[model samples]
Target chain A: MNRIRKNPIFIIVSFFLLINVFFIITAGDSFFQLDNYFYVLKQTAMIIIVASAARFL
Target chain B: MTGNYDLSTGSVVSFAGCVYALMIKSGMALLPAGIVAVVVGILIGVINGTMVAKFNFPPFIATLCMMYISRGVALILANGATIRDNMPPEIGNLASRDFLGLPIFVVFIIIALLIFVFIEKKTLLGKYALAIGGNKNAAFFSGINTAAIIFAIYVIIGGLAGFAGVMSASRLSAGDPRGMVGFEFDVILAIILGGTSLSGGKGSVIGTFFGALVVACLGNGLDMLNILTFWQSILKGIIFVLAIVLNEKVMKNISKKTVAAARA
Candidate 1:
């Protein structure tokens, strides 16, 4: 609980990120499927690159 | 279902074309339609900037109002239709043809992006924009025309929104005011996800582009995964909240480290 308070934001972001990843990974064909591979990559790349670059701005 | 994303083969043109398909199916023109969309978007952006900076209206309120105005105008122009019928011949060609394996729509986006980058990086107005965002009081004290700058920014914002509207019309082959309802939220969400601060001191065009991409990607992923439409909204909202919360934490951490270093 104290740990959560020390870095609530971090925990929150990490939580969502983990959820996203879990859903992406565990859903398999029923969940992930193979048809939209490029779509997923394009999106993940865009988010990571854009979100990380806020440091420069 | 897991770990199946392919990075080597993504095409912006194809993406644009796919969107175009939806518009065309609804009976809208394609070329002039797209051009008009871009112009309107820029107008909306400009209006947003002007209202906030010049009139001294709250930025959030001003933008929110403008969003409704823009959409309402589109709906009125389209006469309550989601797509236009019997568009010009040029419109169909632009939507259908590919240049060197790329859709014309993709080229259009690239050009728009290039112009945006040039304006943001290589111009004095850009410098002033950043300065004002960083410290309005300091910028005004340093002889910058903060009011004029803000007005200009709002116009640009309004204009961009208009452009999006036009694009929506073109893709749908008809001017549908209701096309992509709640899209403003998506735009803001992308911006925040890209790391722009709501407090108005930090933002990046590059970040925005990436943020937009992220949103586009997420939507695509959901579709591929067969996620329900209602769940998409929920997911996006969750992301928005998480981004702000994360940003606050990151800022706090940085400040703490700075203070510790000063003490040392």
Candidate 2:
């Protein structure tokens, strides 16, 4: 069970790194911009609030 | 049987909610309007069940067809315009009303969870849904009413979807045909996170609640960490595959232990 869980976590981290690398290599300056970071967070806020409300559900 | 049930929900929400808004728009009373929308949802489910159970169409195809049909009907019913006017305030109140400082919709979900938990644990309907899902052919041989059970399952799911539709429309104060485009995926992810097997036959209502939390957290975390939506989808798929693998292994171990204990 631990191995099964671990393998996926590793894959997720690796995928995350791979995407970040790709974006940096292609658009280095824009990829690391603070505004972009905030923009993504802004879009994710609603999903978070709606999804987290399931705890109450 | 339920592996594709999510497909029906996507359109059912849109379709039923559309009917609800339209009914009120046409000057129908709140009670009757809500009833009409719910009936439409159940009828769609019955049609889906008939297609899969009696006519021998594959569940995926039949429900996929229903999804498109229902969505089309919704879009047409509103004449491609969003319905925001002429709705009775009482109808909207069902979704937005507060109970003890909590949103009514959240309360509804809790109640739904409680009722589902009871049905899953204490009712024959729950047992049969599992039995049929586990093995339809064997369930048939054992004298179970597989067809009827399957029909009931779809109809129940449809009714729930209808309720969701109405709540959504009420909250927004209008029904938009284009709403909830990919919500089915989020719901499926929640169910799977809840430890329900994608292959069917095993599920826990409580687990689903937790699974929903997990998805929400992951989505939130990803966004906070600056991950792109494109990458988020891929990562989500990976997590689902990994979770299923983990769940299968755990189930196998538990079953093996039970078998050994029986022999002892």
Interface RMSD of each: 12.0, 8.6
Error of 1 at B196 (Å): 1.2
Report the Cα lDDT for residue B14, model 1: 20
Query: lDDT per residue, candidate 1, B1-264, as tens digits?
Result: 000111101111122223343444555555544554445445545555556656676655765575566555544544556443554444445344456755545544555567666766798677776676667789889999877766655444444443444333344444444545554455556556555555555555656665665566567657757899899889888988987786666556655766799999
Flag regions of model 2 displaced more than 4 Å. Answer: A1-57, B1-6, B85-91, B220-232, B259-264
State the weakest 10-residue window (summed lDDT) of model 2 chain B.
B1-10
Error of 1 at A45 (Å): 15
Candidate 1 chain B weakest lDDT stretch, 10 residues: B1-10
| B135: Cα error in model 1, Å | 1.5
* Per-residue lDDT of model 2, residues B1-264, tens digit only: 233353666778888889989888788887788888888878987898888778878777888898899889998988887887666666677764678865555566566667777877899877877776677678789998877777777776676677667777776789888787766666666665555656666666666655654555456556656889999889888977876787676556655766799999
Structure candidate 2, residue pairs in collision: B194-B207
Q: lDDT scores for all predictions?
A: 0.50, 0.66
TM-score of chain B of 2: 0.88
Runs of candidate 1 exceeding 4 Å displacement: A1-57, B1-47, B88-92, B255-264
**DockQ per model, Cα:** 0.11, 0.06
